[model samples]
Target chain A: MVWALALASLALVSPARQAGVMRGGAAAPSFVNAAVARAPRDGAPRVHMASCAKLTEAAALLDSVDVFIFDCDGVIWKGDSLIEGVPAVLDMLRKAGKRIFFVTNNSTKSRKGYVGKFTSLGLSVEPEEIFSSSFAAAAYMEQIKFKASGKKVYVVGEVGIQEELDLIGVPHIGGPADAGAQIELKNGGMVHHDPDVGAVIVGFDRYINYYKIQYAQLCINENPGCLFVATNLDAVTHLTDAQEWAGNGAMVGAIKGCTKREPVLVGKPSPLMIDYIVDKYKIASRNRICMVGDRLDTDILFGRDNGLRTCLTLSGVTTEAKLLSQENQIAPDYYVGSIAEFAGAGVKA
Target chain B: MVWALALASLALVSPARQAGVMRGGAAAPSFVNAAVARAPRDGAPRVHMASCAKLTEAAALLDSVDVFIFDCDGVIWKGDSLIEGVPAVLDMLRKAGKRIFFVTNNSTKSRKGYVGKFTSLGLSVEPEEIFSSSFAAAAYMEQIKFKASGKKVYVVGEVGIQEELDLIGVPHIGGPADAGAQIELKNGGMVHHDPDVGAVIVGFDRYINYYKIQYAQLCINENPGCLFVATNLDAVTHLTDAQEWAGNGAMVGAIKGCTKREPVLVGKPSPLMIDYIVDKYKIASRNRICMVGDRLDTDILFGRDNGLRTCLTLSGVTTEAKLLSQENQIAPDYYVGSIAEFAGAGVKA
Candidate 1:
């Protein structure tokens, strides 16, 4: 049950209004129509527009601004296309001198992929301004000063984690067969005695096998404090069509439960991740910054704790079905149809 | 580590003097000293006593008292041996006509075990007056109408769970290897499959095996709504001796992580568990309850959420080490050496 049900009541609107809004011609009716479509279904609980109103209220509460964060996939576009007038709205925000940073929990792709996404969406985004949990994991390794000199690191991730470690001059220890390599879980690996390996890094690896989980557990158990790092708390991964599948979060959750230790979550909600972003952007004040994401638990909670305004768009991750069931547990301040909805003139105030 | 350090500090004093004061008596000193000796040596930030003081102040601010709750184990004794003055304390409370109930998260042991312990300690206690997570799990299963009849139920627990199921008249399916019988995961089977089994019941099975886990997963995975139950959530269990080990909480946690479905928690701290206790005993009111336990995470959290005043004793699971750890999240209203210390007459309110 996506927020699409919210538009049920507004379904009575004239086809002209729906078309106008869909075409990005009218701002107010466009948002209203989208909200109506995304609201809860009839006979079910009506949509709580408090989240939509929360964004406005939260923005008003802020006295100053620092880093304006944007979650790419849901907020900017669905896939290959931009959401209505998102490009123009982003341009307007940039012209208004708002410092924006693209923040994503996705670790499968590197900065290059994010840059490519911006190019495809017709939004001007710099690679340097993009932050991924993969980057955070790499930064954590560096912060802790793990031995990375020609150290073989195993990878259970896509190019994102591999690239980050590469950029930092960490050698990729391919598999258990690569005897001298540092074992990276989430990739393919088996049990072996490698005294040369300094740490086992966990990242978003799509090709996760049972052997990887078993070997990873063995490594962590054998060498206590072998630097077990996780890319994000994303239990599920985003599909190309916007669906979610099991990801690193699920795998890490298994290990954490088994070990009875919460992983050093190096993702969107962790203070460490936010600190990295703030430091990278040199953001002095966090008062006016707004965090935009589809996840209420991680994104909204992060914003709420960090004193940043939060905007929850119904474009990804959480659906109305999830919201209705978990209303008390996971809640964001604001709701928006899409990033494009913010293009309206009233969005400024 | 354990409140033992504090107890040791006061151990040199006379027992009569100890009975006269709230803490710092000979008995209190011994209890605290024992705890300290058993606790980890590494110094960590302890939970501020001020928070406990604040909770006490909060209770003091309350206008009335209706019920009094008590925690088992450390508050009473370590296993069969009664804490120094627990018997006298209960007698006094009983004589005063104050309502009292034993609250414990020890799902490994049954209500009968607890009743027998009290009798051995020379204190009179009714089965109805005692509440354990094991009993709670059984009652919950019954309330939920878990196996009407001829239901081949898998039992992975001790005699308590078996007794509950038997009393409910639910036919027990033999072990996984037995024809038409589903071996309970807690008993010794990890993963088993039998077409005839109707449901899987999880309780505290000390000898949980890999096959049991795997079989439970298979049974649950095969049937989406197949009942998965847990006795309680005391992450770790404190033995009669000083050492602590992983309890049913960890096993439940494993199953939950694998299934992605939350288990129905039957044990203490659950509202349903609390209700079962209340109904069985027909407690008049809930106002004057004071719950005493060694752990704030389990017992104290239970008391806090359930409108009961909580006291933390330093004889079991929680040691001074945890108190010193900055990461330990929960706190209690009062910190005493033991129930014997609380039973003493001269402690200032």
Candidate 2:
């Protein structure tokens, strides 16, 4: 029934329908066994942050969430290094007996790379606890049973995607190596593509070239039942507090424009990440889980869309004014100036 | 008035208006200060290919086109080698005292590179007779007087774009060199953007990385009234009869998606190419010129939009069924099984 519905959604070329499935939202994210499970509350509450009363209310809300899902790049680290006060807050949270997961949309780093980074940052994180877009993408493929089933995957990313695919035992082609080492591109020449490729997975690739784009396009256009999947369609990546960089969306947009097809984004806001977490961990009650994130669209939307209680930390991307004025904006149940504030507001430092 | 119109169009946020100015079409391609000139006919009759009678009709129609505009790929050559009957046909047409122009949307090759290719193909052609999107892009920048005017161009393309910019004396940054050689993109660490940079020109960059896209986005976002220009938005490049590569549209689409702004495309179907041709050559009567190409949208649309006759050649991209069925499709004045077929039908071979 789900497969049939998915196929049906792909056929609707209307703009309204484009939002339903192409975004990885059509599938039920976390209601594992039953459709009758109550859906998560939408637009929960506005935790005004002007007074001590609101601060206590926000802390109480954070205290209730059994599992705390934190976003990486903006929340815990900036670029390759750890953010200040993040490690301390994380230690405090762990000591308070809360289950923690680091969810990030940055697909450039692999799980192994992330494991090393976590150790360096003085945080005890399990490989399973880190759910990056790269891993989620691989997990998604596995969920759909697209791993080494007489089909190869075409990658448009860096080492992260390759590492995840290797772990899943899925053979892949067309990535950074061929793109970066390319010396000459003849206007009209012998163009080659792997015919066995059945899926094109796009992530945050630094060496995103025309050759890769062409190869990916060929794989999708030539192959039947080829899946066009992207890690995340993030509009921008705040590499630091002062700078914004082009995210995976830029790379995906190029392929999207060329193929005139939408990709199944497997990152935050897609509900796919939460699905991966819930399915793997078998969370007893999802209602107790709270998602703490930096950005509204990816982190907050992921939490909201996946039926988890949401909290927005001003420590990252969202400003209070921008978060408040937008219509139908995903309102978090709690808001704090920073996650660092959590240490002082009733939580043991 | 032009700036007001440009701003108004930008505000419309409608797809139709996106074509008006963002594509460099708002500024007239070339009009020699004459409002009394006769416009070319639209939706003109196509020469039938049913029988010997239709063959003669096609031959007669070809006889009327004094100036022939030929699209390079698929028309003159299939890939790197020349197409079967193009050279002989060109020779015959030249002997018949016809003015010819080779126009292409491939921005990867410069006019000199095109000249070398033409020479190698045994065609005696002048550098000025060849009008590529690369040349047109440079000319457009030159027309706008970007060089030495306290402004620089940030290119998202390869050697062709650099060569053209070099010829026009336009100092450009963010091309192939800086991108392919980039290591460890330190997010938000001393990003050096030329403050005088006023235009971001996107062409076919095979080394299209996240770094380049980010720089291009920053150039446009940071600089006021920076021109967002693209060579062509051709969906696919026919590398050979059997293979298709991702075109400039993919690269341009990335920047457009990231920047959330439109680009001024100076290639076919945008009418800017023909405008450049008309203005530079100072054609007394546009009715005598004919645009011959394989694609309907780019080639036929270019001719139709610029008030010139158009012909479709089956040797390259379009199929008859697709050309006919598309709603409000750009129709041509003549159709042949191939440009080679024209030589066999009635024209000298």
lDDT of 1 at A11: 57
Q: How do the residues A150-259 of candidate 2 rate in per-residue lDDT, one tens digit apiece?
A: 79899998889899999989998867676654534465454577788989999878677767888888888778888999998886776654666777878888998788
Which 10-residue window of candidate 1 chain B scores lowest in summed lDDT?
Answer: B54-63
Error of 1 at B256 (Å): 4.3
Best model per DockQ: 2
**Model 1: per-residue Cα lDDT at residue B313:** 76
| lDDT tens per residue, model 1, A1-349 | 4444424523543343333224221233322223322345577766544223323322332223445688865666654546677777677667656777888877877787778778865677888888888787777778876643535555545678777777877776533232122323222223463545555666655344333544454455555455566677664434343323444555464445434566677777887767776777676755556788877767866765665656678777667566545233444445665766655532563
lDDT, candidate 2, at B125: 87
